[model samples]
Target chain A: MTAHPDQTKAGAGRIVISVDAMGGDHGAATVVAGIAHSAKKNPDIGFILHGRRDELERLVAKRRHLADCTEIRDAPDVVSMDDKPSHVMRHGKGTSMWSALESVRNGEATVCVSCGNTGALMMMSVLRLRRLPGIYRPAIAVMWPSRNPQGFNVLLDGGADIRADAKDLMQYALMGTSYARNGFGVARPRIGLLNVGTEEHKGRAELREAHDLIAANAQTSDFEFVGFVEGRDLPGDTCDVIVTDGFTGNVALKTGEGTATMIAERLRDAFAYSPLSRLASVLAYTSLQRLKKRIDPRRVNGGVFLGLNGTVVKSHGAADPTGVSAAVKLAFQLAQSGFSQKLAARVASAALPPQDASSDDDGGTS
Target chain B: MTAHPDQTKAGAGRIVISVDAMGGDHGAATVVAGIAHSAKKNPDIGFILHGRRDELERLVAKRRHLADCTEIRDAPDVVSMDDKPSHVMRHGKGTSMWSALESVRNGEATVCVSCGNTGALMMMSVLRLRRLPGIYRPAIAVMWPSRNPQGFNVLLDGGADIRADAKDLMQYALMGTSYARNGFGVARPRIGLLNVGTEEHKGRAELREAHDLIAANAQTSDFEFVGFVEGRDLPGDTCDVIVTDGFTGNVALKTGEGTATMIAERLRDAFAYSPLSRLASVLAYTSLQRLKKRIDPRRVNGGVFLGLNGTVVKSHGAADPTGVSAAVKLAFQLAQSGFSQKLAARVASAALPPQDASSDDDGGTS
Candidate 1:
């Protein structure tokens, strides 16, 4: 691998990441720009960029540094944000999202990144790479900005599939812990079961059943089971990982994001309210920026699919170049640590056999 | 009702609000102070204060005007915050919470307020007041500060029960709509079922069934069915009422609250970072206060238990004088509008007959 003048060192190891260049809200150009940003910062990263060949070529050629490190695979079709997961499964061939995941499945790339349809990506991912052996479900784990020493917490099943049983939650606990350990380098991370209250008797019946299952495996799973945690604990310093079904996790994630956005906007409107406030904002610019950086969603952009045979990082669909690059950075780090294999091994070693298997039916559907 | 010199007018009919003064975290003095604040603001409001008579008298005596308008009902026992609902139900006859509810259950008080154990209060409420006819599951609806013209949205069941089926969701729709129309005067309010996504096929099977159930009843129910709404829409102007099972609603509510708290703390840290920013803080004080007031949870501080025979407003256990007064105001407005009776009528006339009654359980538990 040739190092650009901007690069400092490359002795670690070359890591190639598959990129879906066309599926993002922004076109291939913005994705290429993100690749350029990543390339400029690191000397050991390569990309298997998937999109329309001519368009990707034009975009990559503009960023002269990215051209040598990037490979363009011609998958002309784009999987739109509105595409259904089932519909995409049947007609999703030759799309950028499909091509990118294929690279990871076919051993052309260790990790893949896409700012595309989350549901469709999950569908295609399960189809291409399949689940890790003995895994009951595959979940997407995202890094949440928190007051923890690591500055983030891992929250899983961020809408991968809406349903999870007591057994599924136990797997999330294991998978989320694995993600925290490998993705964030948290040694023996603390795991929490998300509930309305932290009490043993609170929440739905399955949550109570899952709580016992997760706690029973804490010693063997090699992580601290913090028991039940409420929604407020998501950003608190108490726990390193929060595990819940996809529906609740997804709602909590969006609720947190929406609240943050509303607060930020309210703050902006406050600073812009009067001439005096405007002057204050100018004087407090760097401090405000410091706070923004502390809570910024872009700083933690990727939702990595865990329990799959290969790793795939789903960036926000409307992500800018900076957001895309943040996701790429996460992808590179996970690939470097061989997160997928370690996560699979963790699940296989610690997971309990599925109980009854009939499931508490009213649990997810009620 | 006797008009204190501090009060301005007494032309409107008298409103008697039953208050469980002893159960709040700060004790009866804070409850008295909150009552005093409310009493000072209006002349037509009366309170049936439940607690140890001696203790209540001492606090009410401090606010001389409150002594004239408040009636003390000695219940001696207090329901501690940690007491389980089942335990409370078995041995709660003499508690202040029970006495307060009794006042509302009887014809003495138009509405009730309490800051006790939520589960205990919920259990006692269903036991004492009973469910309104035709209503299967009782819910707690709280007003959320939002981008709507009304400046708020109604969300339920704020943890009244952890489980709600499709029919319960439909009842919540009508009940939430009734709450909106009576409490906030949002005519022909838009009702939305909270889900992971707004897509027709997204979320759990129960949610889809709920979507159809809710949508089918909207025209007859006199509210616009906005279909499925994501967590972001909880605070958006896209809807005035968001309906979901107890678990999701509670989690989303707390998640939003936690996010707001996190952001506010970060903003404070930002302003206190440096000497220049400290000066900027002084200059921006009023605007900052304005922004703070806009998002403050205390400003919208009551969770109203709906679909019950009588209205019960649960104030935050830690609420100060302002928070208590806000809740008192809601109870008063609800009483004035005959909200409970109107809600009963709405549910009886518009609610779909309980379908199957056997639920899809996997949802909330999952």
Candidate 2:
């Protein structure tokens, strides 16, 4: 892949990543391990593991192979997942999550990755790194587990903001499309607004307006607009990108995660029951092994917080070493593709024409 | 179990079930097979399968052993899952789904079960069966797939109503509790409100108010009032009953279903990959069978629509014979339990105090 002329002039084979070593269930050990794994494979990548020096030192000591690849930046405090976003923003200075985000703000790092409190990460990113000019809100983008070999569907605003208007939804579409092109390498991503139905008048009034905005946009029109998709279509690869409010998106993401865990648990329970069935399971062992590899959560780890000024990927809190490694890989690819810059540019260019915008102005209508 | 006073007066073992024979993915065949399966085990249960004459006749011929236990009632159309709820309500008079619901209203059956359009089922039941006096809206109750041997948690309003106030949420708690005690035979079911957090002010304003209502109520407070639960807790047996709005509940349910299907597909893919992993699967065969049985959707098919005037159960649209059979059994248990009457009494008695009436009067003060 060729680097953009503008980016090529800025740097050569240089990509800095800031990882929140204090974040996630597995803590700094997994993050350090992941960093070591990625560094060995990609020598061009450099990393700053932000956390308490003593804790990170202990973990790094256990993994001597990662010694030369990583540098530790001291962050005294660690943010808990249960803490409120507002509280975190006000009081979380010097914490690993905040400090890591700050690394990106100062250009010390090109990207930030964490498996900590998502709300806190977003809050700190917005407060410190700030939003890209002309962008209203940052959207949390997630890949919906799909049936296709090409992998999953990308959903935006998975849980960033509570309520969004038509313009915000349109912005999500543009940002998501850009990310799909850069990150997933989809030439022309099919975007779908999540709604109760496909009819123009189906959902709440905001949806109807958003539908019109998407349909009328010349910039977005270049990509496939598949109208609307239902909740069931999420895992079926019906569209490359799905967009919705944070409330719905959060619930959908949690529901998907919970369901996956439940099924795995259930499958385990089913195979443990009887001797004959156990024998049958043995006969079908090859098929079962194939199934486990396909559905493993470790294969899909990091979810990008799209529409931000810089790259910020959120790994699952429960992610293990394998999952953490995948997250590092994902972050590296996203950084290399310059996904953040591309998304910002696409959304800015997609702004409605001033004259056409005034024709249906509702600035004071609500 | 002893028969209720009213049921005894009517006749012991005379509960009639109206089944939507032409509904579901397998059409009349699975319905007939389910009826036959239930009839062989339950002498007290009787069926009235509603569908076109010829199709019903052919199905009945295949289940001739159940000749004494089952009978058919003619109906013309079948409501498709994709049909709008309002459209079906306006034009579903002669349809199998509508006719089955009507049988319960006409006293030809004590309970109704259909594997058709869920929205239409709720609409027709509300329109024909009507709500119990003073009950605002009917709730669709479900047995959550719990981790314990205590069976499942009861979740109410599983996509029946879009918006629910604090009062409606309280009623959902009451109805869900009653269903758990009477239907599932749990002495004191633990009730929980689904929320993002356990704190009092965590969720939307309505949920905060609802939490107070549940805690303050004398009747509802008698049941175990575990504060709040997240999506992950649903399958972990954290609470016996969970309450939420229809939109969130519906999305969660569909998301869970989709995830399960995706995992199954993924597991198949995993097993087909290589030899060593296949050998590992063979060694773990017994555990796999146990897992499958525990998570089998067929074993947990019947989902009850609570807060209605009478017993109404919904079978999965894609359910086969085993799933439909489980639904039939659930319908019978619900009818025998007199859960609706108990819920009505509890809710009515809980509202007798005038102090409860003044709580909402100060709404504008906030």
| Poorest stretch of ten by lDDT in candidate 2 chain B | B1-10
Candidate 1: stretches off by over 4 Å: A1-14, A26-30, A348-366, B1-14, B25-30, B348-366
List, residue by residue over B236-271, the lDDT tens digit for candidate 2. Answer: 677788888876676666666667767766665565
DockQ numbers for every candidate? 0.68, 0.38
Best by TM-score: 1
What's candidate 2's DockQ score? 0.38
Indicate the docking level reached by candidate 2: acceptable
Off by over 4 Å in 2: A1-14, A23-30, A40-42, A195-219, A269-290, A351-366, B1-14, B22-30, B40-43, B77-83, B87-92, B197-201, B218-220, B269-290, B349-366
How do the residues B1-366 of candidate 1 rate in per-residue lDDT, one tens digit apiece? 211122212212468888999888888888889989999998779888999999988888888778768888899899987777878888899999999999877667878899888889988888888777667778999888788888878999988888899988988998888888877788899998999877788889999999998888888889999999988887788999999998999899888888788888888998999999999999999999998888988888899999788889999888888889999998988888878878877766774644522332221221
Give residue A347's error in model 2 in angstroms.
1.9
